[model samples]
Target chain A: MQLQINNKTHEVDADGDTPLLWVIRDNLGMTGTKYGCGLAQCGACSVLVDGEIVRSCVTPLDSVIGRSVTTIEAIETDPVGKAVVAAWVNHQVPQCGYCQSGQVMAATALLKQTPNPTEDDIAAAMVNLCRCGTYNFIKTAVNEVAGRKEASL
Target chain B: MKKFLLTLIAIIVIAGGGLFWFVTHKPGSPFDGETASAAPADLVHRGEMVARQADCVACHSTPDSKPFSGGLEMGTPLGSIFATNISPDKQTGIGNYTLADFDRAVRHGVTPDGKRLYPAMPYPSYVKMTDDDIRALYAFMMNGVQPQNVPNKPSGIEWPMNMRWPLALWNAVFVPSGTYAAKPQQDEQWNRGAYLVQAAGHCGACHTPRSVTMNEKALDEGGTDFLAGALLDGWYAPSLRQDHNTGLARWSEDDIFAFLKNGRNKHAVVFGSMAEAYNNSTQFMTDDDLKAISHYLKSLPGDPARDGQPWAYVAATSATGNAGKPGAQTYAAKCGFCHGTDGRGKNEWIPPLAGAASSLISHSESQVNVTLNGSARVVTADIPDAYRMPSFREQLSDRQIADVISYVRSSWGNHGGPVTPEDVKALREHTDPASSNPIVLQMR
Candidate 1:
């Protein structure tokens, strides 16, 4: 099967039902996406598929056959992703750095979808879990990227 | 007056003797007079296939036990009864028994010593099995299977309730003794399918409702209640009939075939007890047999009155409109990713909650049980399914489960009705081994 990952088409040998995270990390050798709760509960394996954030651990390889998958490796290429990365660095939002990539992908997808997202919108969209309690920092950074008044909460 | 009293006593004696004979009598078997002999290799091979169709091992063997060395405990109203060892061991199993003994036990629910086997053995359904199949099954039991020296466990029922003679009367009233007669009106495929479902598959053992006496209401499609859906073992097996909402009205013959063959279809995936059937029996059936089963099941008509309004998907007007409702937020956070916000699961991989039989049926046991305890893995063709419903018992409260299930059952044109926290509580306590006292339904 051919997969469009980070704008590069690659032929991969795998079952269609194989999780996209497995194909992305093992088959494509892009390990930026982290595996947390494989049941899609913890969204640590978040990746942008055709501009929509999908939990790659639950997303089957066949579901994204022709779609573009943007991992943390290619996040800075997009304007929105670039801005989100800058805000993350400015905020120094990394305790373990394992979940930061997925967090960055999630924030980029949110800001891209809702450029002027309010507190409610941010709360709804930024549902990815960060065990290091990096949520307040993530919210502040996402608020900065959205060009909104810095979120006090 | 003394002469009249004597006559009355005589009459009473005769009637009592007749009643005793009727209850204790074993039905005659064609193999009765024959001696035990080794069966041909081909007959034994065919017998193995017959056993697969019957799914004999599902109850007869536990995970750790040797195959056919039955020790699985089944809960009944009287008490728990253990499935007897069917392997041909000389002492512990049925090795010493002749072919006639096997036939009587399998088809007539009678032991050689005049004990009546419980209906849990499903001999009512097995009675429809052809004589040839019985011979083959007997042959396999004697020759193909390894003789395991596993002793049969006694029933936990106490003395008076454990008496077997009454069940002979129950069998007489409820069980029909005959092989499946081909309906000349229907095609060969339908007849073959009917034979499998009614006889070997014994689908009605779960799908058909039981009477107060614990007899299945209907043994075949001749009765409307046959496969009309029944709740058992904490799961509601949905109707095989063609009802639009709670049955297979929307599923095509091909869809049914795919479901049986592949363990999944676009409309639903095999879960609950059906997963065990699929894993052990249905998936192993030949393509032609599956097609025949599909053709026959499709012929059973659904009742409009019983099924109520047919379900069709009603698109949610707005996400915000449903946000205020109980369990909405829980669904979005916990379920929406895999099941989708629309409740249409990811295309054949994850089954759609919208218009699903679990959601459409008024009996919400399947819905609640699956939600609270989660589903068993659906393994198809040796490959475990990519997705599975995770257990939420520890994560969510009984109220949360009820609220979320209520939200699902009521949403997306599903009319499964509201499930109360008590409903969730009962099943939770029942399924949880730590709770100790599970509510066991006393089958009258």
Candidate 2:
């Protein structure tokens, strides 16, 4: 499989049916993309496929061979990623580090597409499972980054 | 060969002796499931009281979910670990657990057969629970709960890290089993609140910051940071102290009671973990207990240095051209429907964002997150209102959110810190909308 991860191209030897999560984790040694639920239920395995946030746990490696696969690692390359990362630290949004990268990836995607997202927008997008249940802080960071996105524009 | 044999024999002798000493000298476990030959006549009654005091059902159970069936996934720094099956079903749950097993899990941070439990179990706080409460909790969990056939989900923690034996050492360092003692001068209410919050409820599990060792910073009121709001699980369990921003500065005892009882009042509604606390613990609490919590919370003094300047709204032009100012326009277009133009909502229904303790926090972190994701659905009392704040993920942009939120904060004399778009983006990536479908695990 030839894959573009965080803008870098890599060739990997893996089964086509293997979840993108395994390719990123076991094959490419990209530990940053976590394995949450292999099922698409939790957004912990979320990554950007051609700038669209997609749950990688369900996305097959075969499907995303050519598309840009953006994980949390590459989020800062985009201005939206930078803003979102800043907001997360400022808000201290991570409880356990496991789910954060996915959360960040989804947030950057949201900001890039929509400069400003409303509370409702936040709800639909940030639906990752946070067992610590820090939904309140997530909203604060998203709103702040949205403002910053506007300021930059 | 002689040295090896001597060492082996010595090892066996030492190991056997250690095992004997361990059984004899182990600190009495609070949740041990060792059942006495004769059952206490009021074991079930005591268990009910203990369950209420600890608010055990809040995290272990879900709204419309199973009671103590343990399917709830608790997110930790490691990974999302599902709460274990506490119900007594030998095939699937803790049916075979003895009283000693329950005590170790609850207070000693050990499972049956001495399996160490993760700190996520809140044993650090639970260790403060009284012996009687532990016994009661054991009785309640073992008997009151409907035995579930649900199998326990393995934790997401990777291999060597998932091992539980190390937790025994962790407990040795942190867990201290002692009931809360009342201060000589403080009244009954304060003591009651202290006991409930510190021991049974384990509010500090979320409210207090953790150390490098993951132990809660301070166990009691000795440390000023006890319940003094540290960011956790994404949301800051805003200071329980009476601070201008992010504390109980503006809430009267009655207001606190209202919020706790019904999940929403005039000021704010509980969401996130607090929402669960309300659904499982606070709402069911007796009126006096709520008042005790209020009294305890109000006594905590705020730190002006940490809180920063009180929020004063001087409306600026909205960043978005869609409305008068982006902030005001967003508020007018979106928020006004529920919060109203004045920032006040219907009593005990939609919460007014004005003068909310959370809105006043020096950091706009919690404020930004909640507005973006909307609130956990509140269905309390006989009134099950379907009017939830819709997810605008498809609608507004982040800047639009900031402007509107800034307007609300400033407009209502709320001195909450100004929000930044960077903050919005970070949380967007960091968080997901709370599931509207409550993880209700029905155990029977």
Candidate 3:
């Protein structure tokens, strides 16, 4: 089977039902994506599939055959992803960087789809879990990328 | 006046005696005069096969109990009753039961002491089992199975209701006599299929509707009611006939065979009680036998009037556009990952919610119960399923479950109507997820 990952088409040999996370981290040797809560409860394995956020741990390989997948390895290639990453660095959103890759993917997808998203849109799209309690920093970073000021708390 | 009184007294005496004799009369068995002989190894093996076909262990034993040691409590309208021990222990089990005694109990639903077994034994359907199968089953029960010393639990029904004699009268009206005779007109495969279904398989015990008297409306495909679907326990056992909406109108013979053999197919995966049936009984069947059963089930026609319009999938308006709807956003967040935003599941692994029997049928119990309790693990060939629906009773409230279920039922061309929080609440109280989890039997 062929997979389009980060602007390159890679030929992969694995069962179709195998999770996309396995193919990405193990098969392609791209370890940027993190695996957490394999049941899709936590979004640590989030990736951009055709510019939409999807939890790759639950995404079957067959479902992403003809689509483009952007992992944390190539997040800076896309313009929106670059802005999201820049905002993340400026706000210091990673106390522990394990969940930031998925968090960045989620913010990039949200901003790409809704350039000027509301707080509700941010809340709904940025649902990834960060165990280090980096939510306030992550929220401020996404709000900056969305060009909206965080309301006084 | 004196002559009338005398006649009335005589009539009362005779009627009372006749009723007593009817209830206490023990039915004679084919092996009535035969003694227990030493069964060969192959006969015991064959008997084991027959027991599998009959799925006796399903109700006969609890998860923690020894096989056939019977302590599963079955609920009845009147009260609860426990399944009796069928092991070969002389005091606690059927160890002392002679060939005649065993035959009488298995086929005739009568113990050697003239006590009538409850209809819950499914003796109505077992009556059609062939004499050869009965002999093999008896041989296996005596020789193959080890004796368990588990004592039988008594019924919870109070005095007047607990009396077993009334079941004798119930049996005479509802139960039939003798073994199945193959129809000459049907082909060999169909007859074999029919015999398995009507006799040993006893599919109608759940699939067929019961009357006011609590007897199955029909015993075989000769009546339209056979395998037409009915509610048992809490789940609605969907129609096995050709009904387009609530039945297997869309499923092919291969699909049915695959479902029974592999525990799933493109259309649906086994859940609810069907999961247990798959794990304990159907998966053990031979390939040819499964094919025959599938063929026989497919032959039963569905009623157009009862089935209503066939299901056709219609795409949900929009994933984000329908966010205003009660359950749309919740579904996208919770269900869309696996069940897809479009309700089409990924391949045969996760079952599709669109055009599903639970989504199409009016009864919302199965959908609600499954959502609240989740599904039992469908372990096929000793491998557990990769994906399972997790229980949401703690995470979601009753209204949330109702809304999400209603949303699924109302969407994708499904006609199952809206569900209320009350329905979800009722099932939550009545159901225990631990009980539904089938312990894979090791019947060595």
Q: Which residue pairs in candidate 1 have backbone atoms (N, alpha carbon, C) closer than 3 angstroms, thus clashing?
A: none
Worst 10 residues of 3 chain B by lDDT: B434-443
Per-prediction DockQ scores?
0.57, 0.01, 0.49
What tens digits encode model 1's per-residue C-alpha lDDT throughout B49-121? 8898999888888766887889989998779999988888999989888889999999999998888998899
DockQ result, candidate 1 = 0.57
Top candidate when judged by lDDT against the true structure: 3
Rank by lDDT, descending? Answer: 3, 1, 2
lDDT of each: 0.86, 0.72, 0.87
Cα shift from native, residue B220, model 2 (Å): 1.4
Interface RMSD of 3: 1.6
Model number 1 iRMSD: 1.4
Please identify model 2 stretches exceeding 4 Å from their true place. Answer: A1-153, B1-26, B30-42, B62-65, B311-324, B435-444
TM-score of chain A of each: 0.96, 0.93, 0.96
**RMSD in Å for model 3:** 2.7
The prediction achieving the highest TM-score against the true structure is 1
Candidate 3 residue pairs that clash = none
